[model samples]
Target: MGIVLNQSLKNTVITYLGFGIGAINTLYLYPVFLGATYYAVTNYILSAANVIMPLFAIGMQNTLVKFYSQCKTEEERGRFLSFTVLFPFLLCIPIGIIGLFFFDDLVYFVSKKNPVVQTFIWLIPFTGLCMAYFEIFYAWARVHMHSVFGNFIKEVGLRLFSLFAIVGVYFNWISIVDFVYVTSGIYFLALIVTMLYAFKIKRPNFQFYIPANVKDILEYTFYIILSGSVANLLLDGDKLMLNQYLVIENIAYYSVATYIALVISVPSRAMHQIVYPITAKLMHENKYEELNALYKKTSINLQIVGGFVMLCIFVNISQLYEIVPKEYSGGIIVVFMIGLSKYFDLILGNNNAIIFNSKYYRTVLFLGLFLVLITIVLNRIFIPLYGIMGCAFATLLSITLYSLAKLLFVVKRMHLYPFTKETVTSLIVTAVLFLAFYFWEFPLYPLIGIALKSIILTAVYLYVNYKLVISKEINDIIDKMLLKFKLRS
Candidate 1:
């Protein structure tokens, strides 16, 4: 718990800092600097990049993480690392060749409905290539057990670059076309810097050698590539599909709301870095008692933390939207819908880590593809009818369904549940707080009103949760933070 807590705290702070910078860019700067259409284009490009990279990289990042520790020597590790660095080229070259032959068809498909996407459509793969390499190098660093610097580069450095670029736009020093190109270049810059650092941490000893377990590695990477693609599609396919059916500006509207909602999942994401390995260790040891305890604690603690975020966002959603451009303000529904989905996924704890680490992970191949299929089907069916709200609905539905299946699988196989008495308490308290504060708004400016409501919400929420002990772990964390503050003072 000590190591987990320390790293989780550091990650939480860094993640929030990144999100803070992103919030500035998404909610404030992009809205003002790029406006609705260009802003939508920016987000669209990135979302597409995320979806495309898994295919290009062929899941080498996850493969690296899985097999790197199994090696018994530096030579074995070096060969494995070298293979991960080089294997992606096999798939990448094919993708490039295909894109070359089908460029017009690809461009036509993307921009047939929304022509703005046509101009920067090719940037998607370029950005995807850069992002894929960034993750590869980031994994390179992580294999050396050095993730903090890479996390900073991923979470904070990239956003900081975007921030400066936005100011360039605001000052008319950067045209929209140039901005798009430079933004893609920023992703490549992150890849270059992170790759350099990865080498600095532990340089990959280049060998024109493939590991003996090339078959196993390829098998795992293939499964991972498909599963990873499905996951990313569920996350970003809405934006991609929206480009086909709706106006490009709608992506901007949806992106802002989705970004705000994404804040709810930060706690779960922060904890995942350390928790995944711990879960794997416990499972390997067949220690059900400890694993169950950790599962319940993480679920309840995430619930308490994620619920607080959801409460603040929902309670002050109206005021939050007030600060955004009026043209983009219609996505309030998207926020709640997507926010709830992310919250549900969070409260399931590390269900994913448990499943992925277990022998039953093969089931994910079927389940993952099903989820992706349904997501795309739903988006295709609904987006034209309900527009951005439809996309939100699709996301919420698919994610909740996916979470439920994971929960059921873990319980049926492992005979443990993530819920305890604290789960009920945390949920009840969250519901009450949301209902109580949602309709009660201050009669003042939006920003001030949001501040006032948030402060009140946090105080009362904390007091009640602490009294009920819905999550002693979170309370312990708060206590430690306060103690450190006092000691420093």
Candidate 2:
């Protein structure tokens, strides 16, 4: 437990630091240098690529994680990796052929009103293929418990490359069309680097196995594809829908707000990376008690961390928007709404991981499909009426319902609940801190206002936690750090 906590904390710090750099690049630098329309085009293209990548992947990224752990020998695992890599290319060719046939119609349908977006639609399939291979190789790396490098490449490396491309565009070294192509090229380069690293660690040997095991893999992959598609739709579908139904510049505004809100999920993302493998191993061994304890602890810790992040965003949202163009200030409401959705997701802890690794996974997929339909309907009804705010509302409603459904499913099927006294305490304290900082405005300068609000919020939240003693783990960590420093002195 101690080791998991320490490593989880360390990894969370690194992931968020990387995400912080990404936020700056997305929110401030991109908008400041490039206009909102250009920025929105970039976001829409990337989001489209992400939404398409899973189709080409054929769910191999997830299948690798589940099946790789089941293999008894390294050679078998290597063969599985080889198959996973080859499978995507096969799926991609047919999809690419179909895309080529419908390319003009699809572009016309999605971006008819905005020709700039239409111009960039060609980048989607190329970037999608690159993204598919990147995940396939990344999963191969994760199976070996080497996640840090792959994460670096996925999270930081690609963003850093795009940052440079933006610089090139700013300096007039390349036209906007070339800039977009360069962004797609970055993913291809990242895929190449990850593949080289994967082979260097364990060279894959291709073998044609009997189609018996392949059948089972395909069935699992089918369920995972449905599940993954719904999940992506829930996460990024709002932006895509906004791009289609609303104005193009609204996509930029919504994206900025979404970026701020999505930061609350960083802890969950980092924890899930470590938790998925651990949960899979535990479930394999029938270690339900250990899994239950992990569920509770992760929920509480994530809520605490995620709560603080949401607090920061909510408190400074006004000042944050003031830095951007006035047109983007409308995103303030979107940020608040989406921040709540992410916080709800955090409170569910490892519910998604547990269900995905359990026998009830198929049932979970059905629920996700239902939610996807709901998300689509809600977005359609609201986006036409309210634009970005409507999209935010749709997301908030869909995510809340989805999280609740998963929570109930876990409790009913597994006879385990993640809520505890600490959970209640954390929620109350967070709510009070949020209310206190949200309504009370300081008369200081903008920067000073943010600093003071942050300080006050942190002090109040920590004091409440200290008074209630909500987390013995956090106290122990603080004690250990102080002890080590004292001994060194």
Candidate 3:
């Protein structure tokens, strides 16, 4: 528990720091300097790359994690690692060939209004290839319980590189077209760094052998590919769809709103990095009791952290939009809708890790596919009528439905629930705190109003949570931090 707490705290710090830097890039620099159309191009291209990259990897990244724990010897693990490295390339060639032959058609179908998109269409395959290898290499590090470095490379390193690319574009050092290619190059560089470190830690030998267990590996990979692709679609498919149905500038507005809303998930993402492997190990040992306890604690912690983030965004959204162009202010509803959806997800806790690591994973994947189809249908129906707001509402509905299904599935199959008396208490306290701030009007200055409201919110929420004991883990962390500082003094 101590180790898990420490790792979660460390990862949370790094994750939020990365998000802080990324928020500047997305919220401030991109919209203020690049304008909406160029920003849309950047967002669309990246979203396209994310959606296509999973297909190129062919699920090897996930396969590596699942199989690494089951291997009986170092030799078997080495072969598994080697297979992960080689498999993505095999998948990439076919994708690249198809993308090359049908490049114009693809652009025409996706974004005919935005001719700039045609110039950068070639980057899709290149970026997808880089993303595929980066995930594979990062999974190699994750299997060995060295997640911090990979987290840095994936979250911070890539963002920092993109920051430089954005700066280059700002200074006219490069065209936006070159900036797109350079962003892809950064992913490849990060992949190489991950590979070097993975080798340094556990040098995988390239002696390929046909193990009897290879069949199981392939089977698991097949299932996970569907699961992974569906999950990717749920997260990234909307932007791609919007690119097709709407103007490119609208895509930029939606992307900015989505990014701001997504900041709430930083804690959930950070915790999952530590949770998945640990949950896998516990499941392997049949430690169901411990697993259930961890699940409840994780749910409470995520809710508390994620709730605060959502509150801050909801309260300060007006000020946040002030930092961007006035046209982007129309995305305020999109921010609230997506933020609510992510908040629901946070409260559900480690449901994803538990379900994915369980034997009931296939059922979960089926549910995911069903929800993806629902999301697509809703987006098609809504985007035509409501535009970006419709997309936001569709996302909110689809995600909430998907989360509920998973929650019910876990309860029925595992005889466990993430909710408790404390969870309800936390909700009540958060509501009261929000209402208190809602009624009190600060001055009209956006920055000052935001800062003042944030302070009041944080102080009141902490005081209420302390009195109510909303989370034992959070209480313990506060105590530990205070004690460490006292001791140092």
TM-score of 3: 0.90
The prediction achieving the highest lDDT against the true structure is 1
Candidate 2 per-residue C-alpha lDDT over 1-489 given as tens digits, one digit per residue, 9 for 90 to 100: 565565466566667767877887877777877778888888888888888777889999989987887777777776777788887787778887998898878988888767778777888888888998899888888777677778788878888888888788879998766776788889899999999898877787877443338888999899878977887778778888987787788888999999989888877887787888898998999999999998998899898889988998897888877777788899999999999999998988898889988988888889889999999999999999999999999999999999999999999999879999999889888887777788766777767888888988887877677667777776667568769889433
Against the hidden reference, what TM-scores do the models get?
0.94, 0.91, 0.90
69-148 per-residue lDDT for model 3 (tens digits): 88898777888788788766766778678877887788788757667788788777777778888888888887887778
Q: Rank the candidates by lDDT, best first.
A: 1, 2, 3
Pull out the clashing pairs in model 2. none
lDDT for 135 (candidate 2): 91
Q: Name the weakest run of 10 consecutive residues (lDDT summed) in model 1.
A: 1-10
Scored by CA lDDT, what does every candidate get? 0.88, 0.84, 0.83
Model 3 CA lDDT for position 303: 90
Model 2: residue 439 alpha-carbon error in angstroms: 3.2
> Which candidate comes out best when scored by TM-score?
1
lDDT of 1 by residue, 404-454 (tens): 998998898889899998888788899988889998799899989999999
RMSD of each: 2.6, 3.0, 3.1
Off by over 4 Å in 1: 1-9, 475-489
lDDT of candidate 2 at residue 350, scale 0 to 100:
90
Q: After superposition, how far is residue 199 of candidate 2 from its true place, in Å?
A: 2.6
